[model samples]
Target: MSKPLVSVVVISYNHEAFIKQTLDSLLSQKTDFEYEVVVGEDKSTDDTLAICKSYGDKINLIFSEENVGMIPNFIRTLKAAKGKYIAVCEGDDYWIDPLKLQKQVDFLEANPNYTICWTDYSIVNDKGELTKTDFGYTKDIIDIDFNNLFTPYSTYTLTSMFRMEAFDLELYQTLKHYKDNSLYVLLLREGKGAFLNFVSSVYRVHEGGVYSLTSNYHKNYSSYLNIKEIMEAVPESRSKNMKRILNSLGNATAFGLLKQKQKGEVLTEDQLKFMTDYFKNGNLKTKLKYFKRRFLK
Candidate 1:
């Protein structure tokens, strides 16, 4: 086939049960332009490799001899993409709308100022039953930039399509943990982002899911680390927003540990040190609030 206009990166591991559905959704996209599915099979011990191979030349499959974890696999798959635009749909997630890629590409083509575009999505169970509809937002968020990218709004990876030129491969490689949030911040640094009104994908919440299955502490700590990395990755001019995000993450981590301590969980030395440093570097308001939460209440 000729060179694709868009490249969809699908990272798969032991997702034997859901890989087929994920591939089918991507293969079913009815786009006017050519797009390739670049599958990064991380040496799955299950039937995921066989399942992906069954698609033949329909997808550009890259299987590793040994597992190299998620972030590395993602980076390598991105490196393999030859399209002008790039999209991500992990093996456990599936797109619901057949015109998902078309809509995103149309927006990016028309709006050169925007670096990335993402739509809303639904939450599905392991059985593929819908648990929630329109899971992201009720309205459109059209003016997302680096200054306001770290808000509570959701930008699911499966529903996003971004300009390949906006990606900073060197910066991404430097990050120890490259989460979706990290990618959003990296791309937004180049330009702005857009949140479409319609839901176009289904995010599966199953036992095997990475972030979904992690504990509250692990989730909070992981977010903190991701934000910290983002702060270091961006330019110093963007430090104000990154610092604010880091402070919020620190608050969440500290308060979460405090809650766990109240429930008989012992705080680790590292956790204690984090709380101490968080308060030490915090502003007056943060100190006052922590004082009230710690001493008065």
Candidate 2:
């Protein structure tokens, strides 16, 4: 009931069945740090809002009369964040490690140069069963150059914690709909990003996720579209880093599209020419990624 040092933000909609477990995991953390769980219930038709309120004083529950999608919901709840650091736990997922907060906070506080730190995750299925998808980012290494920053295929969300300031006005605009990638890329370009060696939580990849229903949800995948926008949003001094970051995002999207389907078929010959020129001028890893993407997605 005392003031919390860390704000554990939980965003939920129609997650009545799984939300309690997620909240319970946050409440049951075995750390010395004082933390409070804040639940932003975005107009659920199900009993999700009621379940969040049932925790009473244990959680700060916000019930919205109007439903905003993930991006707006995040912007809304973040306004209520009262912690030096903000950690996210979606309604469907749970933190497996009780010491997750303590470790992340200690690391971030000790290393002020780093803007964010994210641990690996264990992917779980709808029935709370662990899946074989191996979806979490498993790089047991720390951040190197901007190359590692641009890997468009990271499962880093749901296990990451940030210094809140990463969502500056410039970052907020750059994020657009690709909030996660926007945050990751900005921090990588301007500050440091540490990949924790520990696995911290379960990322429940349910088939009927609320995020699945929205067409705009996958806008992050089109990180290609976010390039020039991010470049312009950032400071001129950081423009070089933005260029590399943008290239990485564009190449990653091309690779993603190829792996997923022939979305390239929608491109005009001119568009294809532009893409091929990008591939030709890119680094070896980027070229190889483009080739694999053209063949696969």
Candidate 3:
């Protein structure tokens, strides 16, 4: 009769080979508080749906009749979720630490100013083999804002846990077709974001991944569009933050254009100015890197 303290939303689509491990790892979490696992199987062409069903009553499963794509599936899973805090781990990825949920929940409960918390994570191959490389924050706990958070791939999705009440549902619906970063931006806009120093999850990189399937240019462009949407979503009252948002967008667009230039695409004068300004206004280390690339041997 009581609601769970946290809702773990797992979105699956043709992740038959990985769903079992993902679910197992998720349900393995040892928590003092009650947490529900909401699995949204988006009509996977493979045996993903069957595997999810095998969990039976252990998880709240929503099996789609047809493939509704990732964004729709994410939204559907979010809708089914009922918890004070929402944690996400795609079917292709799995949680590494059992305390991930409890730790994040505890932190959010203690810190009213922090809206979201994420941990470090490892990268795994399609075969579930761990790669030597890991993704984590350099600092033990980094407080991030909209301007610093808009860059692409700054954090892993599986490691994220956010407060349910911090977001605007109508604004979130506008991002039904956008990537995870769009939601990340909205969460950051609500309050500060924190990163735990410890590794708590594993992100699987394979041909089936949403961004992995596309070219670098496509991913960059998609990130660009997502940033623009966030800019539009920003309230007019927050003019200062809006300016920083524009700066972040400009920096991303400039870098994306540079990538295009490498492939023989010509850059316009306006685009060049954007890049120059990014380096000029960047921090000391960033300015040094730019100078080294521009003038040094």
Candidate 4:
């Protein structure tokens, strides 16, 4: 086959019911440029492999002999991508618009200053029923600076398409957890991000999702450490601002670990110190909350 302009990396594991729909959605994309679908099937014990095989040479399929975890699978899939742009849609999610690829590619081609382009998406349940619409924060096409990417504004993974060469592979290897956020931050460092302000994909929330299986403390702690690591890896010029954001996020996560301790979870000594320092420097309301959580119990 000829070289592809964009490569769609589809990471799959045991999605017997949803794989067909996901593949079909990708195959249906109406784009003027060439694109390839690279499917990473991570040794599913179910019929997912068989179903993917039915597609034959329609997709570039990579079958894992053993079940590698999601991060490994994603890294492998990303390495196999042979395109100028990389668009990701997990196995459980699917696109809603046929012109999704065309629109994103057009925007990226016109705006060389942007590193990533993403659109609004709708949230769907396991049954594929729409739960929430308009998931992105932007109201019009706009550039999101690096600082904005660090904020709590929600971005949809299913709707994001980014330049393949925007990431630093060496720095990416050091990020041990929080793939989505880490990737976003790394890409934003290359250039500004673009928000298209239109719904193009659907995100499925189910019991098997990462958020459903992981505890809040684990997630928060991982984010706290990952953010600190990323901040340190950034250029020295940006260190001061990144450190400020780190303190805010770190203290909040430390406070979360404290809250989880009442349920018999153990926290590290450094975590305790972080919480204490945060309360000491915080306003009266934050100090009150800290005291209430610690002594009132």
* lDDT of residue 23 for candidate 4: 96
**Candidate 1 runs further than 4 Å off:** 133-141, 236-243
Question: lDDT tens digits, residues 178-250, model 2?
Answer: 5465666566555787878787888776765755343431443345565555555545324455566666566
True-structure RMSD for candidate 1: 2.2
TM for every model, in the order presented, reads: 0.92, 0.74, 0.79, 0.86
Model number with the top TM-score: 1
User: Which is the leading candidate under lDDT?
Assistant: 1
Worst 10 residues of 1 by lDDT: 132-141
What is the Cα-based lDDT of residue 253 in candidate 4?
A: 79
lDDT of each: 0.86, 0.71, 0.78, 0.81
Q: How many collisions per candidate?
A: 0, 2, 0, 0
lDDT string for model 4 (67-182, tens) is: 98888888889899999999999998999899999999999999998999888787888675796563446467867665565454556778889998997777787676655767
In candidate 3, list every pair of residues with a backbone clash: none
Candidate 3 residue lDDT tens string, 188-288? 77788987778898888899887666866456546656656766776532346545555555556655665566678877786667667767777676577
List all candidate RMSDs to the true structure.
2.2, 5.5, 5.6, 3.2
Model 4 TM-score, 2 decimals: 0.86
Supply candidate 1's per-residue lDDT for 33: 99
Model 2 regions lying over 4 Å from their true place: 132-141, 150-155, 169-175, 210-221, 235-297
